[model samples]
Target: MDEAARLGLVERYIAAYNRFDVDGMLALLAPGIRFENHAGGQLTAQADGIDGFRQLAEHAAALFREREQRVIARRSEAGRVVVEIAYRGVLAADIADGPKAGSVLEMTGRSEFAFADGKIGLIVDRS
Candidate 1:
């Protein structure tokens, strides 16, 4: 895909995530997409396909109750898109019980996206 198309796809992915649109977000990933959160020690290794991506998204949504998540900045370079985001949200349940539930906490994180075929092929995130 051209650079413009790639950037547009990245924007769509962010929009879908902010809206908690699991299906929409998954649609913007390649079949063998890999998502990683280095700081959190989390990785969704080569989510087999779109179906697998959807499953991951569903599981993630069930863990957090996001009040708001916004992209503070985004830039594209060397065939990759980088985004800085600010998020405020609360856990859905107790950490030991299931998922931790508590007052909203603010977080800032950066995500790097590698685009291919007008979709995200790899995502590396850090806080």
Candidate 2:
């Protein structure tokens, strides 16, 4: 994809994620897309393909009462898009396996996206 299209894809993807629109997000991804999340320099989650990504997104949506991610900066080059992001969310409840409920979480992170056939083929998030 060209630079404009690549950037548009990333922006739309982030918008979908902020809205918790799993289908919308999936529509921008290629088949068998790979997604991974890293925190503190350790891999926290991994998903493969549409189904896997949907499951992960659902779990995330369930955990937060509301979530939003804003793009701080973005760069597209060589079939990859790198984005700096600011995230904020409110917890829905005390998570049995995670953070306490009613807590607000805010953080900054960066994500890298690799494109194939004009769709996202891989995503790596770091925070």
Which numbered prediction scores highest in TM-score against the true structure? 2
By summed lDDT, which 10 consecutive residues of candidate 2 come out lowest?
93-102
Would you give me the overall lDDT of model 1? 0.76
- What lDDT is reached at residue 122 by model 1? 85
For residues 8-84, write the lDDT of model 1, one tens digit per residue: 88788878886889988888888878776665655534355677667777876776777555789988889888889
Per-residue CA lDDT of candidate 2, range 70-121, in tens? 9999987677899999999999979778789889999999999998888999
Instruction: Name the Cα RMSD for model 1.
Output: 2.7
Question: For each candidate, what is the lDDT?
Answer: 0.76, 0.92
Question: Where is model 1 more than 4 Å wrong at Cα?
Answer: 40-48, 97-100
Off by over 4 Å in 2: none
Assess every candidate by TM-score. 0.81, 0.95
Q: What is the lDDT for 73 in model 2? A: 91
In angstroms, the error of model 1 at 29 is 1.0
Candidate 2: lDDT over CA atoms?
0.92
